[model samples]
Target: MGVKEGSVLPDKNQQESYIDKQFLAAPVKSAVDKFQLIPEFLKVRGLVKQHLDSFNYFVRTEIKKIVRANDLIISRVDQSIYLRYKDVWIGEPSVIMDGVTEKLSPHKCRLSDITYAAPIYVNIEYITGSHVQKTLVAKNNVIIGRMPIMLRSCCCALYGKDEAELARLGECPLDPGGYFVIKGTEKVILIQEQLSKNRIIIDTDKKGCIQASVMSSTEATKSKTVIRMEKEKIYLYLNQFTPKVPIMAVMKAMGMESDQEVVQMVGRDPRYGALLLPSIEECASQNVYTQHQALEFLEKKVKKSPYFSSPLEKEGRALGILRDVFIANIPVRQNNFRAKCIYVAVMLRRMMEAILNKDAMDDKVEDYCNIPKNLYGPQ
Candidate 1:
């Protein structure tokens, strides 16, 4: 039969290879071939591109959010005297000398043995004095501090400059600039790798106890919550909450009062019920069956904190710890802890799984595999 127009013919080599393919007993691959595309990728996006991007984000966006988060500052002695940050920004690279301000360059800074940095300006509103004569003042473009500028960042003098311009500025055209020039010294910050935040990890501890841990992180706070099995009973461990608490007690404190409700929330599996029996009995042994009773029990176990001065303030200490400190990333709005309670339940279920199946626990190598890393900067 004749081949039709616009029809494709398979390559004889490809067809033959596919038909005669033999599976390898061992998986073997070429390392050079595996990374061959890296250079091409780096050509388009330079090696230090991420660092520059991160620094630029910090200067342009993250700093503003940080300022807004900590915007208000009240005088300790006089509550009425306060300062509020309106806005913040990173100015162009510059230097002040002999009552003269001049544009600064990385080359000049290197030769002069000075840091190539930019000025941080902030707009603020403040009330001066607590008396009736107190005045509200608004200020703009006030120099707050100097921040080290990453070379080739948006704020850098050499940014967006061509090779000829770079040559005039005494900068190497091939130098991928992501380091800070402090006192004429080049400092490259190594990116730090760590376990991801707001993630639950189930693993076995050195003491042979299986535990579920979550490094909860939020804009306001960062905390860790751990649910571990010890002596066939589950306990909750969180910093600032002295002494290990029974898992059932913590569940009840978060308003899961009924044992059946707690068990059902964990799972419908009968194994979960059997595993949670010891923790539930421990809660009962301590007379922490009701939510009120659980709160009161936790209140006594709370470590003394500077925040709680009076008995009225201390009354809500346990509730505050649960709402703010424990699994802090899971926000509890208006004292509603439904989400937090569910998270704890999930942690408990994961802990049970780890205890039941050794393979269910996290592998140390695998745990580090996908961790997010960050270059040292404002963050």
Candidate 2:
């Protein structure tokens, strides 16, 4: 019979002598092969000189991106502030050495108690008084600021040097350098791990109740949104809602009108079905079954609180929050009720899974509400 497709066939490249394959024995009692194996307790630490190449590359490339992302604006009264940055560059240090400009050396910085850094310059242009466009500010390069350089990096003075050249600069031949010089001291940048921002994280409390939270942050605003389960009821804590608002009210405001859909979204079985009963019953009792009614309920809640000055302003702000509450880091219509429905469904799924799977309750936690920082030395 022919071999069927999708079957694992034995490889035909095996090559072994009869004596070697049939029996294996050591040539000597304590013999070892030099190229055969390595020990399990051995560790491999990265070379510092090797890391300098990569770190310097990031400083040159990523610094430009960081600067462009946060560009500065200087308004001018005499001339229009039309000048904007085009490109950024790193140049040699302009420190005066016998009335001549020269590149900074790591040894020189170590002896002088100064930093080993280079000048950062930018190419800029703007319109002049004649309404003509694109004029440079200076005859030559324009200096912006200084950037610290890593020792033995691509732009370092000792880079690409031979033994004689390295000795000429007063550096040890065996030294592998990857550090910053400041005030005649060597500083090494350590790695830091942080929690991801602007996303939902589901966790269980000590009582086994599920909590879904998101740290919402933008350039100008930051708020922590939390939805927690307590006493068999789901509540949402958000801005301007002094009393925790019902998650069902939020769902209804997002246009999930049918209680059947909400209950079925949670699950159809008896155990899961019980989780949605209280929320659905509360939604029904409040008479907030339609989108318009839900918006009015939210408006009333916001207006009843003492935060807003007038009814009209409170109503407007409540409406805005009802429409734009569930999204961040992306642009969409302000009142995209469909997106909110999807978000509600996902949150419900997380809670349902946490309730059904007992094993999931003890899963590892990545709750980085506050990070711990360690101090290395006696300082």
Candidate 3:
């Protein structure tokens, strides 16, 4: 209680404080400023969370997929060249130079002005014509080439070291490691912000020209298949179709034999039917009807330097070429022809919707190419 006028009672700050030291837990403090300390802790946390997964994915999955994709083609090439070889498999990754396996360190890399990379080993077996026997190469690991390694990644030598150990190994105590040590240099792979891959990106320019492209990426291939609307006509660059195949021809090629069917597949809407009329008419003018005939027309459009040996060989090549040209991941086990046709139909439907809808044309849609799970356009 205040006893004097203009005089304050004992303030909370002026009050005496006491603690029994024996009962108190050990005090914790650091030399670093609290503000600075927080940011440093956050920096490490951020690095760990924002870690790039590209390297790990590339090694574990992408490398194997690449090998598998090429295995058959390599085998066939060897057979034609009179050399016999089996499938290919990548071996344990290592860093080797001139028949010597070496430890890859960032400091050494920087000093030597060399990239901190590891050899991509490939295990392969071949046969001798005289013996007719499979012979394993002396070295199971054949050096394919060198690939850059990320620092502190599973592959890095310093990965799993304690702080004290890190210092002994010439690492900074405060350095939150997410960078790659290239030839003794601290290098980092910058975090890049990009549109989702393997999806269609749709956007329209100020000129009112609608443009769309699907970045098709499969285990074996990556391609930016583009389609654009110019002069009120849709021009598609789907796998081996010509630069400007009219929309109707593609529809017809995909087993849309009649205008009514094409119109129905697009939608029951009268507007959709009207939008398809020009394409259907143009398709009729080109006379692309049956799949066989449509394929033939596509084959004619493909320009090449070396012609095939025989009609059978040409046709066989055409089959593979056509599939890869317009779409991907079509296995012999499935009804690829039908599936691809349907896929194209759906693609056309979406493209047409984007072309017609004023809002969608102006608004950018990432991953826009794929049909939604609903199998129907927005109401």
Question: Of the candidates shown, which would achieve the greatest lDDT relative to the real structure?
Answer: 1
Instruction: Write candidate 2's Cα lDDT for 1-379 as tens digits.
Output: 9999899765555433334643356443343652343342222433563366466655567656655744545444434655666677777643656987766788888898888888878876654554455454532367788877777777678778888999999999767777778777888876444334566667776776687766664433356666777778888777666567788887787777777777776666777668877877787798888868887777766635564566554656665665544444322365666665666666676766676675444233354443222111100
**Model 1 RMSD, rounded to 1 decimal:** 5.7
Better by lDDT, candidate 2 or 1: 1
Off by over 4 Å in 1: 1-29, 74-81, 131-135, 307-315, 368-370, 377-379
Q: Rank order by TM-score, top first?
A: 1, 3, 2
TM-scores for the candidates:
0.84, 0.54, 0.71
Worst 10 residues of 2 by lDDT: 370-379
In candidate 2 the C-alpha lDDT for residue 55 amounts to 65
lDDT for each of the candidates? 0.86, 0.65, 0.58
Which regions of candidate 3 are displaced past 4 Å? 1-44, 75-99, 127-139, 193-195, 205-207, 230-233, 238-241, 305-313, 316-318, 329-335, 362-379
Q: Write the per-residue lDDT of candidate 1 for residues 1-379, one digit (tens) a residue.
A: 8999999888998787776345433443788855886887899997888888888888878888778867899876577899999999999989899988899999999999999998999999999855869999999999999999999998998999999999999999999899989999988989887777788888877898999998887656788888889999998888778769888998889888889998999999999999999888988899888999999999888988786776776878899889888999898898898998888889888888877787888764566753768665443
Over all chains combined, what TM-score does candidate 2 have? 0.54
User: What C-alpha lDDT does candidate 3 achieve relative to the native structure?
Assistant: 0.58
User: What is the TM-score (0 to 1) of candidate 3?
Assistant: 0.71
Better of 1 and 3 by lDDT: 1
TM-score top scorer: 1
